[model samples]
Target: MHIDLIRTSSKSLPHQISETLSQRISSGLLQQGVRLPSVRSLATALRVSQVTVSKAYDVLEKRGLIYCRQGKGCFVADPEHTRRQEDGRWQDVYDDYLPRAQLWRNFDYSEVKYPFHIAAIHSELLPLKNIGDSFASLVTQQPELMATYGNFQGDLELRGIMRDHLKTRGIALASSDVMITSGTQQGIDLVARTFVGPGDTVYLEAPSYTGAIDVFAGRGAEMIFVPTDSEGMRVDILTRMCDQRPPKLIYTIPTFQNPSGVTMSIAKRQRLLELARSYRCLIVEDDPFSDLYFHAPPPPTIKSMDSEGHVVYMKSFSKVIAPGCRIACVAAGGNILSRLIAAKSASDLGSPLLTQRAVLPFIAGKYETYAAQLRVTLRGRMEKAAKLLKLYAPPGVKYILPEGGLNLWLELPASPDIGKLHELAEQESISFLPGDVCYSAETPSRHIRLCYSQMNETDMEEGLRLFLRLLGRFLQMGS
Candidate 1:
């Protein structure tokens, strides 16, 4: 029997061999009951030490990819054996995971829960009672809205309310410039479709929001990820990129960004806007987390600062208000906005009229008292989570103290295998996002992100303690 020894780098020999062998066995290239070569012979042939070959076999046995008939040798396990062992593995993973993926994929939101939820970000602080009241009043007062299709530009009154409310944040735009979408995910897709055709390039943060990246990827655009530091997107690198191959659009969160919790400095914002103009690229500024800030007032959005009108700004009410409400709005230049609205007409007819109507009263200060109360409620939860993180995190795990936003990025101890941690965390019924998942091609292995916005202090503490416990166990395993 001929077997190809896949070449592996010196550092990853064991893992590479195991992965290669696993694929071979799974594909039925290695038949059941087939005796594999002795570890000593394979090791000498592959120019690796005996230990490396032994480790590969050990892992394959552990994963049930192969079995050792003691004193005989390693042989391929029965294909049925592996299949039976995984009888419901994919289903379990999907039942547990598909909700989050669907939520990210713009699936129906009627039963959606924010993935990795902690329960505090939702029911505790949202003005659900006020929202429910407005929603009922709208449906009762104008039952025709329910019977008829909503306007393509969304509810006129709600757009007017948004136009007026945005003045406080330094964005002055007419209702015509606003096109309400199902959520920011749709807004991003609209922008991607409007400007970026197949093979076009778009620049964004290295470890940026995955949902946005998925949208661009689906549209077949080439993504160029620029690194970000505490101060935010590396403008110098962006400048060089623009000088080389100017991308079709520049996507960013100038305010408190997700995952990293790093807010872009005002100077970087200015440079970014300047770069967009000089390069003549559209800037998709996603500001979903801007309103969640725990610190001083954020700098005005890049769109607000744009004089040439190269920026199309998107904002979501899901994180700050109520996700189930499913409201997001985009403000762009007159030209871009017009094109986006035309596309919106084709995508879903229009945003839900009642949902838009329900948001108007809340934005118009009709529910100011409760809104203020909710802000205080979220701030308290954030502080409590921070305190617990400071208490329980193991040494070498680093994180930025966020001003706003639901999550914090943790740089962990021991360059532990994140896939293993994900498996371990899954076993314990606790979930977290591995750092590599957030990144675009270049994976940063020494990190993970946790969202405190969904959980209360007690749950945050409990979840973190569980994470630390797993980390300790992983370290003990010498991985």
Candidate 2:
């Protein structure tokens, strides 16, 4: 119950006192349910004002380390309860549905101040005020939207807006051809659930979006990994695979393809569509990063080349727009679009009407301007990151300066231990997505994906510098 007070430091008396109690609770020195000394007594003993001790206890209670029972004073919270509250036992139920090892797990680095692993736009770059105003307008204009379940196909107005948006990208689609999704991930899941099932064959780029891989694998689909090169997925190899074992679905992120950041050539896009039609395979073209190009626009999407209704196109706004909005749309013709709408109804009735309406104004009005500005900002970040890499990257490190995307894929020296490097990088407060996770198969890779968009210029430089130093040390030791 005794707290040793430091009387001579610049830190306020309350923070130091709170830190001491936090340490005790965390270390188990103060047992759960152990009653703490009364504020009056502790204040008297420490020779500090009662208010300072009261503030300290307030900090502890706020942090869930302690709780006060009015007249009974404060007691240390049950560590078990605190642990449960912080991280629940959801895995107990989840394990029944999927093997714990097979489930897609992403490292949470929210506590890490400098994070390069996240493939998300920094919040500072988001058009928050504009979106906030849109939300406010929705509430003022159509208050009933809050109480109504939207159309199973999504908000009609939002879909119409997306229809026009897709048209600008050379993807001609009507409102009937479009289905709103929570994001590209959900769009992928909806497609997988509608078309793919156990024993169904699915083809994905060797290094593809992990979320899509999880969705297809979760549905018990047998995945065939198609190798990709600087020109994007090797359509020649895919053609060979199609001849051998025609897949039910071919999932691709052809525009600035994920992790590798390579765009498919126009010829490949046309040939891919032709192959899909010939093989009677459905192509799920996930196009999230096409609008993020720095130089000339990427080739026409495979979906754009798909005139035979062979392609299901998904475009996500969560990356370029606000992530919280969770707005994305899928474009398909015929029964595919119809089945996706049915799946959408089964998933959650529909995405939130409120979110759909909130983003409508932005799409209808300032979207083009916002996207232009974002491209400029992101291009600058990409350039800065490229310079840092050139200056600080270790010898034998190789990478393709992405034509336009948020990520840079780095290939370490031959046979380097990525796991050890990851451990050391984490110890230094840096994080990245290892290349193995990007693959559909379980295999070793000496590559890592570094997302530069999430970090500001300063943190990005510092994190890369630290990573380079650690990488060099690790390589030297191996040599």
Candidate 3:
């Protein structure tokens, strides 16, 4: 078989040749078990040196795209054997994981540019020097940590630091009550795995964090979405739902909710905690954005008010600090914390020690000072984004100026089709999370979530302009 090599490009000839052959194998043009041209023959055919052809073959072999045999030419690797499951038999074994897998598959937009779907803090705002210095100190002063596994409950010093941190927020918990997780996502998964199962009911805010929704749904928990107003999840509605059928877990983002960006009122927070206690249901309070408030600090967390062990509070540092560290703490009483710790141990042995060590000093030392400054920067961005939205949003579109958090939820007019709008936005290189994915159940939604914190000031404004232009065009077409 003749293999084409591009020698004109700036890339090394061997690299170009290997990439071409790899593509052929991946595309199935080079069938499994088919022997490729010999190194000498291909070198002569392409008028290149044998060393170059051999180097290309070596590249392909190392990548597992091809395998070399003694006294034989290289052959394409069998795609079936490389796949996780050769046939469909493994489907029965991992049937439970497919729903969440499919959810993630559908949510992927990695290829999109200027994406507003992500809720992460912009990288530019992170304290790079502080994190780098902490990491460097850990490596230089305590190199032994590199070879050892950390405590399954997490580093003792970090837990102590997190305990002190929680006290300032009104949640009193001992160091033992706090368990370290990879992040809020893992904390949610651990709780879901330990407490929920098929046919168990899990209540969540109507438009909640998609990650939480996926985790609970994957565990086969029956999801019941509680509607939200400007004040966050309606505790009254939740109370009625609990009376009808007590849920196993009430998963909520009470402070600066994921898509809605609404903080629960203090009265509602108290009522929700009381309802959870009376119903004997556990509340998984995901509080990632509470520290990001623009005005005065939001109300006391429900976990703070829980004298009974009814609330599992997960506080993520990824929002304010570097996400690369993947450090977060879960605070729950002994009974639940034990189960969560067990689940965490079963998941990954423990989170990386180096990362925990790297983040500990930052959390203990400069975190409060950094967060105070970050809040101001994020508030400014939020205000600027809101002003742009107000000026450029399509006529009749409605949105509430969020008091805090990185996202703004937009409610489109009845005329413009959401699916069409998404398509048009993509054509303009703009992207945002469609509201339907945030819901536990599929339904028509005239809403979208725009995350203002993922992009810089310039990109944020430009993207919003593109998005509004498309939205206006779609509205006009529908009119």
Candidate 4:
């Protein structure tokens, strides 16, 4: 390697050198399997100490941008990876967002301390060891389950256990009524495919799950937003919408909804069911966080109150259990179940039987116990986070005390553009989901969602403190 060919400023030698070298390898100027010079030799050529070159190479190797063999010199690593690495420049890979909007789809997580990761309503308090043991047992006893495709309806054992479990939630159904999915998101997609089509009207909560909104729009459904408050989706507005062009489907997260942790009242659930049946519309109820309640016992799902079989209920073990397990269930009513099954069969034969077996222990009786434990733990964490926010929330922000679930929705006092907040947070290594991103409509933006699930009491406090600090600074700068 030529010494003068590589150049960097001594002011920040290691970082500059690393970036320069990363650019070369990533841009293919340095081809894969091309050996890097010896650390001392490169240092001498660049007029830097051996330690600086060594440190740069160390960072490159750790990032998988380059690799070092035992005796062979370090060489450029895979550059064609679809996903970028920790040291990657996301803007180089994906198109950039506008002035102040958050281009979150391009977020790189490795280097971020907290990076305001408030988009996913997931919890880190998952049952790993117990579930892992169950998986091992399945592999040992029912090894054939892995080799064969799962039944279209899912593992019969899991479905049976789930049927009994649903009884406690007041949703009465049999194994035949249920189908396993990759997650609630896929369940929502399958339901969308089953009932909706191009130009079909679909009713959505004003700020619903972004993924669901994307799925519905991707299917070419014309979305109409029904306003939502603390009580959940406005039934009166929905009733009016039904009178007009009745929506083909209504998507809602009734219990402990994402972004806003509002659980619908029983009266609203009944009204929604009535509206669905009256209009002959399908109600796709996502209740993944119903089990993570910290307030009063959660109300019965819309499916339970359905008399006309208009509701399609979906839940996931991903939030409560391990996310990677990819175990989810959906209970369909009317002819929707059959259509969903057909769509699901086309989407993928079925969810894995091994995943089903791994979650059986939870479905049988263990998940309930584990869930109870998690609720208590989460309640404590939520309290801590609330206290921190209440104490340290910067002067132009407002937030509600969530009833249950992993996220906190905040309304910025001055309505700063999301692009500004995203940029500031990105600089601070913090990431968050601005509420506007969740909306499918054009409205004045002033909201953000904070996830408190992954962080402990300390991280929650620190995260909230950092968030308030950043927002306060933004308000001052008026950027």
Provide the overall lDDT of each model, using Cα atoms, as 2-decimal numbers.
0.71, 0.81, 0.81, 0.75
RMSD of each: 9.0, 16.3, 15.2, 14.6
Position 124, candidate 4: lDDT: 51
TM-score of each: 0.76, 0.79, 0.79, 0.77
* Number of clashes found in candidate 4: 7
Worst 10 residues of 1 by lDDT: 93-102
lDDT of 1 by residue, 342-361 (tens): 88999999988778878777
Off by over 4 Å in 4: 1-110, 118-124
Runs with alpha carbons beyond 4 Å of true place in candidate 2: 1-95, 99-104
lDDT of 2 by residue, 369-419 (tens): 988888898899988888888888889999999888799999988887786
**How do these models rank on lDDT, best leading?**
3, 2, 4, 1
Clashing residue pairs for model 4: 100-419, 101-419, 115-430, 115-431, 116-430, 116-431, 116-432
Q: Note the residue pairs that clash in candidate 3.
A: none
The reply for model 1, stretches above 4 Å from the true place, is: 1-120, 366-371, 442-444
Per-residue lDDT over 41-144 for candidate 4, one digit per residue giving the tens place of the 0 to 100 score: 77886788999998989988886778877776677775552333446543332421111112324244557677456433334566788888998898999899
| Cα shift from native, residue 457, model 4 (Å) | 3.0
Residue 432's lDDT within candidate 1 is 72
